[model samples]
Target: MFVTDNFHSLKQKILFFILLSPLLLSAQAFRSYSNEFLTIGVDAAGLGMSKSVVATTNDVNSIYWNPAGLVGIEDYQGSLMHASYFAGIANYNHASFAMPIDKESAVGVSIIRFGVDDILNTTELIDSDGNIDYNRIQLFSSVDYAFNFAYARNLIFKDVKFGVNAKIVRRIIGDFASSYGFGFDAGIQFERNSWKFGLMARDITTTFNSWAINEDEFNKIKDAIPGENQDLPETTEITKPKLQLGVAKSWRIGRMFNLLSEANANMRFTKTNDIFSSDVVSIDPAMGFQLDYDELVFLRAGVGNFQYITEFDNSKSLSMQPNFGVGFKYNGIKIDYALTNIGSVGNALYSNIFSITIDYSFFRP
Candidate 1:
């Protein structure tokens, strides 16, 4: 039988810590959002569930979702994903690899990039000779990249695992400016009976980005307008820590079906449109479920990003983002697809995501 008493006690402790998070972080909370590209997420499975897989992720994608789950990797695995946003105006890509080092330890690495390519640079449309020159126009790209290194180890306690990540961030906007940043993340996962719990702390030490602007390039735009782009931009950016808590449960039906459901609370110490917001913190909660037949064919759904919108009439309305997905897995190869709405219901911006993963241990000597 399951030990309900122990479960309750642990639950209470987790709740207490969650409640105290705001007080401990509010003093250092930042007013602006930084490194937003990292928040877009990787892998179709997680996005299909509105990124509610913190406690259940077990594949190479765990390196991005919750590193603690990397302990679930039993074989060398590789994953890749590609998606386009804003009607194909931007591209997002991710690649990752994970392997078990021993019975109790695992390691992973991941790379992500988001870019908008072939952007027309019209600043030099009119040459110094005061003549319109289409040939002077150039095409450039704005891109953001992140490299993650993760490690996980099982604890002495039966089913508990912990992990940490060191990440390097890079951003480039043509030749005008660039930035480099570093950050860390930590996560923990544990299970009791059929219940799973996970906690992920991102940017635990506050990510810092330092920028460099090329003065020669800056001079071109500095004179584009009389009073605009005159002063140098800010050179430093800071990203405050954020927390995510997750709970999951599983059930078996008949002989060929199984169901897994999860809920997550994403917390940031800032006032925003999230469902639960205060001056000290804001909480955005999400729920998702997956159903599979014989562990092969799967279906998933989720709803999240709950926000209160103020209308032009000074009235408020509730809005949320919804997502759906399907998957098939066989012989260690998995393919997943998700149809997600990236914006509010009223805006209705939709995107299609596809991801694939494979176990490559068979290729090893």
Candidate 2:
């Protein structure tokens, strides 16, 4: 009876969180800050499916998407993914390994890095000639990194699983400034036959970043541009919790064909200027479809990031982005590729991602 009561209490908490999330936001101005890299999906498979894998994720990549899905792994697994973001101007990489501790529990660790390389710092002090001396320029880069440790376990209630991720985040801009933060995520998954449901709460404790700046170095480059106001360093940045909910269904079409479809909703409780308007809340909906041929090869497609805009004159517009990918499995190795659409920003941009996964069981001995 105690276990039953706790289960009901958890359910109530989850419902309350979902219902009250939007109301929790205040009518504050939108701002952007560090750890934005966390918004990027890491795996090729999930990116190809427009990140609608919250319910369908069942592999090592689950370390980033939905930790509860880690309970679906049959054994030990490792995966690596790389993407050429923004036409090779930036790089995004992810790696993870997961091992089952018991029949009902698992643990995983993962790392993610996203950054640009060898950017020429044009703000260096001018040379004697004052011809915008190229020799004074130095090479620097901006990078973001996150380390995640996750754990998942099935509950006494059949088909229900819970997971959590504790992560450390660091962001750097050459030697001028850096920020460090710690955050946590929690997730729940439920599976019944071919149907799955998932919910993830990110940054449940409101991630906080403490920034340290090299004021001397920054002052040297301040006002490098004519008539430009210098930027003052920030001491701290805070990110509020976000929520994702998803549902998936699978069907066997015949002896050699199988199909899966999933839908996901992403909600941000924080105010962000990047959205349509100065709304205190934001929501993005995504959908994906996958077809598996004998469980050997898979074709996938998805659409997401539908933003609705309202003009001052009461005009409305909508923007939709789509992504596609394919996957092949041989023996214990699986390879996946995805082409993600970046909308019509600056002459049609797209990202190419490649990922590989190896699955092996340590219990064979």
lDDT of each: 0.83, 0.78
Error of 1 at 254 (Å): 0.7
Question: Candidate 1 — worst ten consecutive residues by lDDT sum?
Answer: 19-28
RMSD of each: 14.7, 14.4
How many steric overlaps are in each model, in order? Answer: 0, 0
Model 2 Cα lDDT, one tens digit per residue, 190-267: 999999999999989878777677776655544333344255544677778889999999999989999999999888
Models 1 onward score TM values of 0.89, 0.84
What is model 1's C-alpha RMSD?
Answer: 14.7
On the 0 to 100 scale, the lDDT of residue 341 in model 2 is 56
- Model 1 lDDT, residue 286, Cα: 97
Once fitted onto the true fold, the runs of candidate 1 whose alpha carbons sit more than 4 angstroms away are 1-31, 342-348, 361-365
Candidate 1 lDDT score at position 7: 45
Per-residue CA lDDT of model 1 for 1-365, tens digit only, reads: 14543443344344323322222222122435788889888888898888999998887899999999999988899999998878899898999999999989999999999988987765566555555577977888778899999999999998999999999999887776778989999999999999999999999998988777777766655543356446666677789899999999999999999999999999998998999999999999999999999989999999998899999999999888888999998877889999886433457578899999998765556
Window of ten residues with lowest summed lDDT in model 2: 19-28
